[model samples]
Target: MTRTILTEAGAQTAPSGDALWLSAADALRITGWELKPEGMCRGELCVPLPAGMAKDGQIDLAAFWGHIGAPLAHDAGGTVWSLGTAASERRQSLETLEAPDFTLPDLAGAAHSLSDLRGKKTLLVTWASW
Candidate 1:
């Protein structure tokens, strides 16, 4: 049976499997990463993966994601998913003492990215109701 998976790329349809096995096409559409002979390639970036991760033309999403030292979480029923930044990228940001970039909507619902304010002194005040 096929189910709707909620990922960072939004909802995607995938068949049931032991791993989050998705077709090469679906993998690229959902994750923007493609399994190439040189490993997973996204544009000029490619990360080498282990052998046999792709079987019958499908790749294991969870395995590929974890291999890059990123975080992924799912509900108990596996219907929802969340992807987080990779450790390597986070480490790089920490090394540079730069704040992580993120996007948020302004008062007029205009979306803005922290990177848009790059090279400017910006103060970020956040609030959350626990």
Candidate 2:
């Protein structure tokens, strides 16, 4: 599933199994934190950001954002930024509770239910091409 948060600045989209990147406006809109050419801010508080923001309005995101304290890096393209892994202090996985049963349609339009595998050990893994 895809999760998104719409803020006054813009829409921040974070797909499952993928990291999140927020523009200066996006970060301010969602978290009420503004990214100056210097770093992040919310009135008097200013965080000395990292070396992500070049001459342009881009940011390389410092190693602190919410509970996932990881930095966001930009490649040579400068178009796409990669949000690195959560801090070592975080859990290996963020899922802390079991989910409710849901059904998904197969390629052939057959419905598959999680409950169907109740008696077996089920491992669900996810990935993206990036």
Clashes of each: 0, 1
Candidate 1 C-alpha lDDT tens digits along 51-80: 877778798888888888889888777655
Instruction: List runs of model 1 lying over 4 Å from the truth.
Output: 1-18
**5-99 in candidate 2: lDDT tens per residue?**
44323446533222344456555655566777555777886766655442254333333453236545544544434444445523534354454
Poorest lDDT segment (10 consecutive residues) of candidate 2: 54-63
Task: Quote the lDDT for 77 in model 1.
Answer: 79
The C-alpha lDDT values of all candidates are: 0.79, 0.52
Q: How accurate is candidate 2 locally (lDDT)?
A: 0.52
Give the CA lDDT, 0 to 100, for residue 102 in model 2. 61
TM-score for each predicted model, relative to the true structure: 0.72, 0.34
Which residue runs of candidate 2 sit more than 4 Å off their true CA positions?
1-18, 53-56, 60-62, 66-130
TM-score result, candidate 1: 0.72
